[model samples]
Target: MKPLLATLFVVWLSACGAPEPATPMTQAEAVSIEEAWIRETPPGAKVSAGYMRLVNAADAPARLIGATLAEAARAEIHTMFMQDGMMRMRQLENGLEIPARGQAALKVGGDHLMLMGLNTALTSGAQLSLQLQFADGSSTNISVPVKPAMGAADSHAHH
Candidate 1:
């Protein structure tokens, strides 16, 4: 009887060690984004910048092919690089690649989404909607708030 009880206990422990069910990946659920925001621009400025960290949790690498925003006449992926001792920004035609299980950052003075021909001032605390297109025919709509540039000194604060 003790031998049978030990056998049953071993079987129960083995069952507990079995792997959990794998979660299905949905197009709507595959990608995750963080720290998405649009920088606050001065009044009457023609262009502003958008920044975010795009995370690809899927099994395959993903590409950000394009983006659209209602507040701007046009939106394009851009990269900033030093050329001939000058900082220059240019549109990326091929799209930004985000490796599988990795992240791509669109930050200030680096890779960013350029919003041109602004329809209105991007004031602080205002939300902006953006649609991002991916190579896998998946798209995501994100709402980002406009915030002051990071590390900008407050002018109202006295020394």
Candidate 2:
């Protein structure tokens, strides 16, 4: 009877030691950009900001290399960092990364798309076409509406 009990204990231990199931590897479905919008910057400003939600349904990580919009002469990835008690925006030369099965948000005072050389003011309710390039040699086109800049106090709001 003792030997039988030992055998059962060993079986239980083996069961407990089993490895967890592996995450399946599947082709990454093209990412989707939702609620894309350019903030309404003041007239004659050299820079404006854009924000959006990038959803990556794929099982692997992906990188967003660059973007383009008709309203801006150039688009770039930018990040805000606190330096010497001040928030400063800097261009991200390496681009943005979206984790597997996750999402990254481009919002104010964080990772955002910079719209440089704005030809016109981004008035509320105006829509613009933007193109996003990915690391996999694929790209996506999205239509984004212009909106008022989020107030300083309300910048943390998320969908």
Output the number of the lDDT-best candidate: 1
TM-score of 1: 0.77
In terms of TM-score, which candidate is strongest?
1
**Over 4 Å off in model 1, which ranges?**
1-28, 152-159
Q: What shift in Å separates residue 76 of candidate 1 from its native position after superposition? A: 0.5
Error of 2 at 6 (Å): 60
Q: State the weakest 10-residue window (summed lDDT) of model 2.
A: 150-159
The deviation in Å at residue 55 for candidate 1 is 0.8
| Sequence-dependent TM-score of model 2 | 0.75
* TM-score per model over all chains: 0.77, 0.75
Instruction: Give the alpha-carbon lDDT of every model.
Output: 0.82, 0.79
